[model samples]
Structure formats: C-alpha cells, structure tokens
Target: MNLLKTLAAISSMTMLSRITGLLRDSLFARAFGASDYTDAFNIAFRLPNLLRRLFGEGAFSQAFVPILAEYKSQKGDAATRTLIDHVANTLVWATLATSVVGIIGAPIVLYVIASGLEGPAFDAGVVMTRLMFPYILCMSFVVLAGAVLNTWREFKIPAFTPVLWNLSSIFFSLFMVKYFDVPIYSMAVAVMVGGVLQVGIQIPALKRIGMLPRLSINPFAGLSDPGVRRILKKMGPAVFAVSAAQISLLINTNIASRLGAGSVSVLQYADRLMEFPTGMLGVALGTVLLPSLSKANADGDPAEYSALLDWGLRLTFLLALPAAVGLATLAEPLIATLFNYGAFNARAVTAATAPLMAYAAGLLGIILVKILAPAFYARQDIRTPVKIAVGVLIATQLMNLVFVPVLGVAGLALSIGLGACINASFLFTGLRRRAIYVPHAGWLAFFLKVVVAVALMGAVAWFSQAQLDWAALRAHPLLRAGALFLIIGASAAVYFAVLLALGFRPRHFMRRAK
Candidate 1:
C-alpha cells in the first residue's frame, strides 16, 4: 500500500470532520454556552463516545484488523467471508445488548460519573444519556463495516464516514433545536441521527467489497467459530489497553464535575482543539500503518514491522511537534476566536486557554502512543499496553490530585499530558527491550531538526501573539479570525521554510516503509 496516499485520504476527511466539529462546537457555545446545559450535554455525549473509543475504534479495531489480516493471508475467500459474517453478527448483538442496558440504567450511570450533579443538570444528563446510548449500537455496526472495508484496502469511504456525524450534529443543533424546545435534547437526538447515518454510509462500501454480513438474531452464533473466540479473547485485554485515554478523560470529567459548573465544558472544548492535529496526523497514520503492520506480521516479517513503526514515529514527530507548539502558543487566541461568542465570555475563554496549552504540551506524547501502541497490537501483544496504560492511569490521577487545586481544570489537562509522556516512555522502552522495534539510525538527528524547527515556529507565534492587540481584535469577529489566520499562516510558513532549509521534504515522509 502507498502509506502516504492512504494517510492523505484519511487526513483530508478527518480534517473535514474536525472543521465541522469546530463549527458544531461554535454553534453549541453560541446556543448553549458553558453552563449546566452544555455540561450536561458533554457528560451525556461522553458516555457513548467513551464506549465508541473503547469498542469501536480502540479494542475492536486493534483485535479485529490483525486477525482479519491473518485470515486474508492464510484463508481462502469463502473462509474470510464466513469469518466476517460471524464477527459482525456477534458484534451487533453485543452492542445492542450493551446499549439497551445503558439506556435503562442511564440515571444510575449518570450519578456515578457525575455525583456532583443535581437538579436540572442531573435530570438532563439522564435524559440525554438514554437518548444517545443507541449511538453506541449504531457506531459498533459502522466500525464493523469499517474494519471489513479497511481489511479489503478500501479506505476512503470508511475515513469519510465521520463527516456524517459532524454534519448531523451541526444541522440538528442549529436548525432542529426549536422543534424539541430544549437545545441539548435536540443535539442529543441529532447525535443518534448521526450515528445511524454513520452506519448507513458505510454499507455501500462494504457491499462493493462483497464483505457485508447478513443479519443474524442469534448473539451466540459466532461462539461456535474459532475466529470469534480468538477475537473475544483478544478483546479482553485490548479493551483496557485502548481505553487508557478515555479513562483519563473520564477521570478529568468526574473531577471537573466537582470543581464547579462549566469546568467539564472547558476541558471538552480544549480537548476538541487538541484533537484536531492528533486526528489529522496521528490517527491518520495509525489507521493506515496498523493494517500494513499487521500484514507484515502475518507474513512473519518482523523487520518490515519494525521499519513501518519507525517510519510512523518519524512522521508523527515531524507533524505533532510543530502542532503542539502552535497550539500552546496560540491557545488564548484560538479559544477566544473560535468559542468566545454568546454565553461563552472572556472568562470562559480564559479558563479554557490554560488547559488548551497544557494539553498541547502533551500532543506529541499522545500522538506517539497512537503510533507506538499499534506495534504491540499488530503483533498481538496486548498485555504490554494494558500494563503500561494502568500505570499511566495511576500516574495521571496522582498528577490530578497534586495539580487540580493549584491549576484547576488546566491541571487535569496537564495530568493527561504527563500521562501520555509516561505511557509513550514505557511503550518505547518495552519495545526496545523486547527487540520488537529496532530504531533506524539518524532518529536523533531527525528529531533534533524537528525540534529546532518547532522552536523557531513557536518563537514566531509567541512574538506575533504578543504584538497583536487581542482586545481590539476580539471586538470584531472577522478581524479576530483574520488575525488568527495570519498568525497560523505565518507560523506554518516559517516552520516549513525552516524544515525545507534543513533538507526535509515531502518525499521523505512519503518514502515506503523499509
């Protein structure tokens, strides 16, 4: 596969999703602002989203892709198709059962996650959680189809599917709010609509590949299949391994719930911005690399696997470092310009800025985890990541305890970053010790060049931000946007120019693994 081409496809679509997500967030802030309503929505939306991460994108993909790759490599077409049907049937039943229970137990779950909630916020959370729980079921099916399509080397449709979600949320939140009388409820329903769209949009691709599964009512139908058992077995540890980030965010949210109103919203807003680069680069690369690595592993080629991982790490460092610097230096302006309308005031922006910067500091660390964890998973080594994740979770919570009182929500963001750093460190060290990933020479020099380029970019951004009059710019939305764009453009131009001078080129990243 052309790794660069695949990454480009996914990144472009992810960029669209992120842009619409920002627009949705902007509309959300304008309509609901950072209040009990938005807080409730964040909590409710997070419940299913957390599961989506744990199951849809995280554990399921980690366990599914490599095994599917193995099936494709070693089994005939008929066997592979059978495997797909069995897995899909089993997954659908599981997701539906989980969603049903979640909907029924929404209040109990809400209370545990947000004990500080009372009155309207608590009630709203329960209602919205029930409304959004079906999203988990819809998206599980979507992820199943996506996994099949990805295994078939059909990347575009699956990558593009997320756009439906953002569009659904933006449309309903903006236009459908009046029909429901409550804006958050409208948004929650839109999320369910989006989930259905996300699943529906992938069907054509799955059909085109001839891998779409027949619906089966029997949940245990796949238990008779050995492949299904393998998937279930792998899923157990992969769940914990892949859920580390979500767990950290959950911890932050629960802690923020007690810190006062809007704290959760602020962290959510900051995280959305932080995710833009991570999704575009880190996620894009990981999505492409995983299948490629899995193919190599299935072929019993450890050298190629190591080389693919190295290439991914190099690409991540190049992209994530400058992005981290840009976000950290321009956090205030970014938050103020994007989310400073309606009920989102200067105080809200101020509260969000620090967390944005703190989170940005760990952008590279988190992206590294995305790049590195697949190394273990592609080889079907789930236990290492599970252990690393548990240790990181502990370290993160400890940081939260020490920093929350001192730094507030920003401290929680900082703790997440710290955890990412620790997680990446442990993963890297383990890979080296086991000789699972052998680094290519020149990584040190390559990393240094990237660091130097980022430093220059950060300095320019910091200087530009200092010289610009934020108060004057903030008075005019267009001017604020224009100024922000100028800063971003200038910083990007400088960063790339420095890299070009340092002999970096697009072809360097595009080079085939090994």
Candidate 2:
C-alpha cells in the first residue's frame, strides 16, 4: 500500500476508536468524578494495565512482530503459519498463569503499587484490581493475535480493538452510574469485558483472511527458532527502553496518589486526553512504520529505510505539534467544556487542566520517540535504546520527587514531559550514529513549520476559549465539544494554510500514488 493510503487507513480506524473513547471518558468523569474511589480505581486498573503494556503489548509486540514479519518474509506462508501457532499457544498459557497469580495476589499487588491510599480507598482498589487482573490473560493473547494479523499487513482489527474498551466503559459509566449506584468496580468489569471482546473480535477477522490462529500450547515451535531467538535477544533492550516510559508513568501515578484524595484521578483524566493525540498520531505512525521499516531494514535498503524514517518523523511532528499546543493552550476550556458535568465539578476541572498542559510540553518528544525507536528495533538494536530509556526513567522519577513536593500533581506531568524529551534525544542520537536514517536540511524546515503552526493555532484557541457558550457546554456536551473542535480545527486550518504558503506541501514526505 502507498504511504498516505496506509496511514489514512490506520488513522481512520484509530480515529473511530479514539472518538468513542473520548465519549466514554466524558461519561466516566461525570460518574466517578475526582473522588477517592475513582482515584483508587485508576490505580487498580493501571497496575495490571501497566504490566500488560510492559510485557505483552510494549515488550512482546516489539519482539514478536519483527520475528513474525521476518518469518513471513524469509520462510514464507507455511513457516510463518506454524510460528504463529507456536507463539500464540505458548503466550496463552503464560498469560493464563500470570492472570491467575495476579487474581489471587491482588491485595499484595495493590499495596505494592500504592501503599499511601489506605482505608476504604485501598480496600476498594484491591477488589477492583482483582476483577481487572485477569485482563492480562485476555488481552495478552489479543496482542499475539494482533501480531499475526499485522504481519499479514492487516491493521484494521488491532486498531479497532481499543474502540470496544472505550465504548464499554462509557456505557457502564453513563447507564449504571446513576441507576444502580454502583462503585468503581462496575467500570472494572466493563474493562474486563472489553478485553474479552477485544480478542474475540479479531478471531473472525483473522479467519476471514485465512490467518485465523489456533492455540495448541506448543513450547517447542519457538524453541531455538533462529528468528524467534533473535527476537528474544533483541527484546532485552527494547524492554528497557519501554520500561523507561512505563516506569515514569508509574512514578507519576505513585506521586499523584500521595498528593491528595483526587490527585490520581486528575492526573489520569489529564493523561487520557494527552493519550488521545498520542494514540491518533504517535501510535498510528509507529504501528504503520514498524512492519514496513522492519522489511526495509531486513532487506538492507538504506535509501528506502532513510526515506521511510523521514516520512514517519515528518508526519509525527506535523500532527503532534498542534496537538501539544492545543492541549496546553486550551486545557481548562476543553476540560471545563467536555468533562465538567454531572459528578465532575469545578474542583476536578481545576485539578486536571494544569497537568494536561504539562503533558503538552513534551508532546513532540512523545511522537518522536515512537518514530525513531522503531529504527533501532528494525535493526534489532533493542539494548541501546533500552539503556537510554532506563536512564530517562531514573532522571524523570528523581525529578518528579523534587518537583512534586512543590508543584503537586502537575509536577508529575512535567516530569513526564522531561522523560519524553530525554527518550527522544537518546533515540535520535542512536539513529544518527547508526547512520541508517540521517535527515536532510528540510527536516529543520519541517520542525520550524510545525512550531509556527502550533504558535498560530495556540493564539486562535486562546482567543476562542472566552467565546465558548457555557450554556451549551452545560446542557449539550456533544455540541460544546463540536464547537470546541471547530474552533481549534479552524485555527489548525489557518496554521496549515500558512505552512503551505511558506513551503510545506504535506505530500513531500507523505508521497502519493501515481
């Protein structure tokens, strides 16, 4: 597939999911607000979710996909087919064991993650964690299934999986929050149910494409397999790099929990908004680039590899820049307009806004890391990035300790921004030293263009924030969000128009089909 066409497909599917997630979170904010139980729920849910990303999605996918892609490339359909069965069955059994252990050991796990939030909050958190712990087993297999489909150049199913998570949570928060008067555990159930659906939805899609994977619990299929072993070897460093971000996030949570009763909720709320753009741009770019880049790197196509790296970076910055500006400039207006309803109040609004802006500061770094790290992974140089990533984690957590005492929870967001900046620097340095993906002077121009666009866009958002209809925000949230979207969108238009007038064609990096 052509670059833009492929990106559009991934982005469109991801957009559906992200939009649905926004609707879900809006409801969750109202239902739970920024309360102790809500804060506890965020901790409870994030613990297993954190591990899920660490081991399965972030760590495993980084390893699994490259190997699977290589298997398809060198060994052909039959070879890749068997490898998939071996990997899937092996992972399923492992995830099952982990989930069972997590379920039984929920209390200790909860305490380990968050010792500060005791009493009802801690108790509720443990219970919620127990309910959600098995999600690891359910979703770990989902990642394996996604790896299978992704190797076949199929991204729609995996991209679509997240939509269920958002929609299910939204449904429970809106319908059940009022009628049943249930605690946060109800939302936990929604998350677990979503995991089941996430994996289940992919099965039929895989079957339709003649890639439906079967699980037979084979430990030997991957044993000593050259490609698989290489993946495992390379995965060591990728885990370190990934752990940097994950560890930084956990530190942010850990610090946020100690701030006060609702600090964790505020940070989570802000972080989720930060995630929306990162999800839409960074993740979409990374996912699309990985398989293609792996093939190019494996084939030793230096020119194609550099060209693709440039393409990913350009798109990453182009989209990420404005989002950062928009979030930073309009944090309060956006939060007040969308989530400041029902249970979510003025206090919650005040708490979440600053951290969202803090996250905006490092938005570019966030996207750049996703764009560059894959270049190393494409070469199986996971250890280099991992070391750098670990350094970043240490620096960020240390900084969080110093800052959080004075800045409160917003300090955690600032530390996150710092961590991303460090991660990007390390990844870019490695990519340059490797001399595999060097850039032209045009990259500097692209950087300047993104900055100019965001500056112009931020100005427009600041002006429009005052003009927002408060009554509409209070009465019809969707309408208010639509208006807010339009305001920032129009601003983005002006910014892009300026960029095109200046020099950016938007298609130079994103080459079109003939």
Candidate 3:
C-alpha cells in the first residue's frame, strides 16, 4: 500500500468534511451572530463532541484499533469477528447508559461546563444538552465501525461519513432555524439527526468487509471475552490520556464563559478554522499511520515502525508549516471573508481573527502531537501520553492564569497551542529515549528546505493580504472570497515552487506499508 496515496485520498475526503463544516459555521454565524444563544449552542454541541472524542474517536480508537489489528493479523477470521461482536455489544450498552445519565443530568452538566451562562442562555443550554446527549451513543457505534473499516484498509467510507453529519447540520442551519422559538434550537436538532446519519452510513461498508458486528442478546456477554477484557484494560489509561486533553478544553470553555457572552462562540469559530488543516493533515495522517504502525509492531519490525513515524513527521513539516504560516499571515482576510456577515460583524471577525492567529502560532505543534501521540498509541503505551497530557494540562492552566488576564480569550487559544507544542516535544523525546524511533538521515536538510519554503510562502501571504482591506470588502463578499482564494493559491504555488527548486519531490515522501 502506498501510504502517501492513501493519505491523499483520506485527506481529500476530510477536506470535503471540513469545507462543509465551515459552511455550517458560516451559516450559523450569519443567522445568529455571536451572542449568548450562540454561546449556548456552541457549548451544548461541544459537550457531546467532547465525550465522542473521549470515548469514541479519542480513547476508544486508541485502545480498540491496535488490538483489532492484532486480532485480524494473528487470531484469524472467527476470533476477530467474535471480538468485534462482543466489543460492539459492550460499547453500545456503556454509551447508552452514559447518554441517559447525561440527559438526566443536563442542567448540572451545563453548569459544570459553563456556569457563567444565565437566564435564557443557561436554559437553552440545558435543553440543547439533553437534546444532543444521545449523540454520543450514535457516534460511539459509528467510530467502532470506523475502526474496523480502517483496520481493513477501507479508509474512504470512514473518511467520508463525517460529511453526512456536516450536511445534516448545514440543512437545519439553513432551513429549520425559523421553525424554532429560539433559533439556535435548530442546531441541537441538527446534531441529533446528523449523528444518526453518520452511523447509519457505516453499516453497508462494514458488511462488505464481512466484519459487521453482531450485537449479543445479552449486553454482558462480552465481559468474559479475553480480547474484550484486554481492550477494556487498555481503555483505562486510554481514557485518562484522552480525558486530560478534554479536561483542559472543558476548563477553557468554563473560563471563556466567565469572560463574557459570545466568548465561547468566538473561540469556537477560530477553532473551526484551525480544524481545516488539522483535520486534513493531522487527522488524515494519523488515521492511516496507526493501523500500519500496529501491523509493524505486531510483526516486531522496529525498523518499519520507525520508518512510518519518520514519513509522518517529515510530511507534517512539509505541509503543516506552510499551512500554519498561511493561517497566521492571512488570518483577518480569512475570517472577514468567511464570517463577516449577518450577526457576525466587523467586531466579531476581528475577535475571531486574534484567536485564529494565536492558534496559528502553534499549528505545527498541534499537528505534530497528532503525529507523535500515535507512535505511543500503536505500541499500546497509553500511559506515557496520559502522563504527558496531565502535565500539559497543568501547564496550560498555569499559562492561562498569566495570559488570560492580559490577552483575554486569545490567551486561552494561545495556551492550548503552546501546550500542544510542549506535549509533542515530550512525546518526541520519549520516542527517542526508548529507541522506538531513530530518525533517518536527511532530517536536518528536510528541516531547512521546508523552513525556507515556508518563509517565502508566509511573506507572499502577508504582502498579498496587506494590500486589501478585508473588512471593508464585506459588502463585496464574492470579490473578497475570490481575492482570498487567489492569495492562498498564489502562496501555495510559491511554497511548492520553492520546494521543487530545492529538490523536494512527491516521490521523496512516498513509502509503502504492509
């Protein structure tokens, strides 16, 4: 399997998902603007998503994929299918219980997440939280199916399924807002519908691979399966590792809520922009790398394992650095062009731009964490990342204390970015110290070439953006969007042109995986 080709395929699907997600956010911004209600909706939506990451994509995938890959490789078809059935059965019951508890405790959950909300905003949050709480149950099943598909190298289905959720949200945001007494409630409805659509799409793909899970009649039937027990044990530290990061986000949201109304929404807007590259590159690469890395580890091939990590890191610098530079240099134009309409005014654009730039400052670090953490995860060493994550959480909050007072909401973003850098550094060090990853030759040269190209790209972006009054062009959104795309295109051309001139090639980065 050509890993670069696979990365490109998955990234393209992710690109579609991110594009639709941005459109959804833009519509919501236009319809509702940055306000207390929008804050309520963003917070409510984030709660279930945070759990989905913790138990679905984040911890569960970390614990599940490596083991599932091991089963397919060594345990034969019958045993692997049995593991799948029991695991799915166990996860369904667990997430269903979690959803019920969350729905019943919606008020307390909202208060814990963002106590600063009051009046209608607080009430709306509770209602929306309850409405969307069951989203976790849907997504848990979706991600479990996705992990199986990825292990089978059926990447496209899992990668494309997110677009279903995005489309559902886009529909409701565009058409159904008017039906609600409180317009933002449409978004909550969208979340529930989207979850169903996302999970539903996975079934046909799973059946095609002959790995569709059969839920046991008794939910407890999976408890005695040795493979299920192994996964459950791994999940303990996996949950902690993922939870530490989620806890930091939870704290940041609470802090933002206290900062003022719309603060949570502002950070969320900037985060959506950040997610574009992070998802396209970080997520796409991580998704492909983990299963391959697990195979390498299962075969006890340290050399192949190290080579895979090297390819991911080198690719990270080549692409992520330019993206980070583009985001930082073009922050205002990007924000103003995409979001400077409806209730998202000039002030809102400016508010979001600062955090976007702050986020850009640590984009490389953030993407690197996505790459580095998986090395540990593939080796089934969740405890190391959990320890690092906990320490990073403490450090992030400490930085928040110093920066939030001076920088406000941007401080929260800045702290998160810097903490990601810290986390990635520690993971890299751990990899080296354990001799789990020995850097291949040419890294120093690779670093210099990417830096030079990124520097040239950043200059082009900065100069092009400065020539336009992005906010003033809000009246001509098409022209603004056209110019923004043109500038980005030109900047990308320059970055790649420089790389070509300096000896970088697609073939240089390509690698085969078993």
Candidate 4:
C-alpha cells in the first residue's frame, strides 16, 4: 500500500467524522449548554465511550490487529478464517455479558465513576449509563469487523463508519429531542442507535471481503482455541496498559464531577475540541500504521518497520505542532464560533476556553502517543507501554493534585497533557533502546524548519486575535464562522509558506510506497 495515500484516505474520512462530531457537539452545547444536564450527559456518555476505548479500540484492536496481520501474512486463508470466527465469538460473548452487568449495576457504577454525586447529576448518570451500556456490545462487533477489514487493507470503510455516530446524534439533537420530555434522554437514546448503525454499516464491507464470521455464543469455545488464547493473552497486558491511561481521564472526570456544576461539561467541551485534530491526524496515522507495522514484523523486515515508524513520527510532528499552536491561540474563538449559542452562554465559553488551551498545550504530545504507542503494540510488546502508562498515571495524578487547586478544570487538562508528554517520552526511549526505530537524518534541521514555521503561524494567529473584534463576530453566527475560517486560512498559508521557504516540500510528507 502507498502509506501516504492510505493515510490521506483515512485522514480524510476521519476529518469528515470529526466535522460531523463537531456539529453534533455544537447542537449539544446549544441545547444543553454547560449545565447539570450537560454535565450528567457527559459523565454518563464517558462510561460507554471509555469502555469503547478500553475494549474495542484500545486493547482489542491493539492485540487483535497484530495477531490477525500475522495470521494473514503467515497462515493460509482457512486458518485465518477460523481464527476470526473464534475471536469474534469470544469478543461478542464477553461484551454482551459485560453490558448486562453494566446495566444492572448502573447505580454503583455511577458512584464509582462520579464519586461524590447526588440529585439530578447522579440520577441522570444512572439512567444514561443503563441506556448506553448496550452500546458496548454493539461496538464490540463494530470494532471486530473494523479490525478484520483493516487487516485486509480495507481502511476506508472503517474510517467512514464513525460518521454514523455523529450523524445519528446530530439527527436526534436537531429533530427528535422535542419528542422526548427530557432532551438529554434523547441524546442517550441517540447514542445507542448510533452504536447499532456503526455496527450495521460495516457488514457490507465485511461481506465483500468474505471475512465475516458466523455468529457464535459458546463462552467456553474460545478458551480451547489457540488463536483466541493468543489474542486473550496479548489482550491481558494491553487491557492493563490502555486501562491505566483511560483511568487517568476517568480520574479527571470524577474530580471535575465534584467541582460543582458545569465543571465536567467544560472539561468535556475542551476535550472534544482537542479531539478534532487528534482524531483526524493521530488516529488516522495509528490506524494505517498498525497493520503495516505488523506486516513488516511478520515478514522480518525490521528496516521497513523502523522506516515506517520514523516516517509516521516525523509527519505527525510536522502537522501536530501547527495544530497545537492554532488550537491554543484560537481556543476562545473556536469555542465561541462552534458552541457559544442558545443556552451555551459567554460564561460557559469563557469557562471552556482555558481548559481548551491547556489541552492544546499537549496536543502534539498526545498525538505522538497515538502514533508511538502503536509501534510497541505492533511489535507485540505490550509490557513496556503498560509500565510507562502506570508511571504516567501516577505522575498525572500528582500534577492534578498540584494544579487543580489553582487552575480548576484547566488543571485537569494540563495534567493530561503532562501525562501525554511522559507517555510519548517513555515510548520513544523504549523504542530507541531496543533499536526498534531509528530517527531519519537531518533531525536538527527538520526540527528547526517546523519550529520556525509554527512560530510564524502563531504570530499570524496572535496578531489576528488582537485586531479582530471577537464580540462583534460572536454576535453574528455567520460572521463568526467566516472570520474563523479567514484567520485559520491565513495561519495555514503562512505556516506552509514558511515551511516551503525553509526547503520543506509536499513530497516530504509522503514515504515511498513500500
């Protein structure tokens, strides 16, 4: 596959999904704003979303993709097919059982997730958690199908599938909310519907590939299957590693839950804004890199593996830096443009802005972790990341302790950024010590070019902010969006112009098709 082309395709589709997600969030903010209703929704939403990460994308994909890639590269078609059947069966059964327990134990789970909560926030959480728990089961199937397709080099379908989620939520928020007495409850129902659609959309793709597995519910079956056993083994360490990172976010949310109204909602809005770039670039790179890296490892091509890692890292750094700078510089405008409407007042925008900037501070580091963590996972080495994650978790909590007392939600965002830096540093160090990856030549010069380019971009943004009358822009929705686009366009132009002037070219972003 042309790595650049594949990355572009996935990135484009992810960009679409992120755009839809932004729209969905804007509607959510307009309808609910940074109130207890929104806070409760966010806390409730985080449960299934967190599980989706831990089980579906995090541990399951990290563990399953490499093994499946290995099976495809090394084993015959029949063997690969059989392995998928067993793994799919096991994954489905486990998720279903977990969903049942989650529903039945929603109150206790809510308490655990939110710590000190009562009244409407606690009640909404319990209701929403039960409503959304089945999403995990649906998403387990979606992830399994996505992994199978990804291993087959069918990247576009899975990349496109998440758009269904954004679309579903957007539809409900716009149209169906009035049908329900409590509109937030409509959002919860939208989530469950979205999960079903997310799974359904992948079926045709799986069928076309002829890799769809027959449904199975035999719980003990995978225990006796070799491929399933191997996946479960890898998944064990992966679960712990991914869980550590996720737990840090959960800890942040739990703390924010106790910080009074709008705190959780503010953090979530900031997080969603940060996710725009991270999803488009970071997630796109990781998805495309994993199978390629796994294939390289299976074929015993360490040179190719290292080169791919180098290429992904360099490209990620180049893009992520400018993104971080832009996000940090434009946090308020972005928040105001996208979400400062309806019930989402200027005060809520102000509340969310600082945290957005704080999250932006670590955007590059967070994206690095996204690309770099997969490197270790692709190598079938899970222990290193787990150890690093544990350390980062502890450090994150410590930072939270020091910063939260002063900065509030922004402190939580800062802690996460610090943790990301720690995670990225450790992953890079581990890869270097093992000689798993080697940085390309001209590192000093490359860093110089990117830094200079981003500096210019930041200057453009800073100057624009000072000159523009944001209050006037905010009063007119269309004007706000237009001005935002103009500023962003100018920033991009200056950044790219500087890069080109410093000898960076379009081809620099692409690796040779290998």
**TM-score for all models, in order of appearance:** 0.98, 0.95, 0.99, 0.98
Please give the distance, in angstroms, between residue 315's alpha carbon in candidate 1 and its true position after superposition: 0.5
Model 2, residue pairs in steric clash: 241-386
Give the lowest summed-lDDT range of ten residues in model 4: 465-474
Expressed as tens digits, the lDDT of each residue in 315-341 for candidate 2 is 777788788888888888778876888
* Clash count, predicted structure 3: 0
- lDDT value, residue 498 of candidate 4: 93
Q: What digit string (tens of lDDT, one per residue) describes model 4 on residues 1-514?
A: 7788888999999999999999999999998888787888888888888998999999999999999988888887888998988888898889889999999999998889888577877898799889998998999999999899988889999999989988999999999999997779999999999999988888899889889887765676767888888889989889878776578899888899888889999999999889999998999999889988998888889999999998998898899999999999998889889998888888888899999999998898899999999999998999999988888889999999999999999999999997898899988998999899988798889998899999999999988976766645667999889888999999999999999899988787777635
What C-alpha lDDT does candidate 1 achieve relative to the native structure? 0.88
Candidates 1 and 2 compared: the better one by lDDT is: 1
* TM-score, model 2 to reference: 0.95
- Comparing 3 with 4 on lDDT, the higher-scoring candidate is 3
lDDT of 1 by residue, 400-510 (tens): 889999999999999998899899999999999999899999988898888889999999999999886664466699988998999999999999999999999888777
The order of the candidates by TM-score, greatest first, is: 3, 4, 1, 2
lDDT per residue (tens digit) for residues 166-224 in model 3 = 89989998889889998889989998999999888999999998988898678799999
Q: What's the lDDT for residue 498 in model 3?
A: 97
Of models 2 and 3, which has the larger lDDT?
A: 3
Mark the regions of model 4 whose C-alpha exceeds 4 Å error after superposition. 469-472
Candidate 1 contains a number of clashing pairs equal to 0
User: Best to worst by lDDT, what's the order?
Assistant: 3, 4, 1, 2
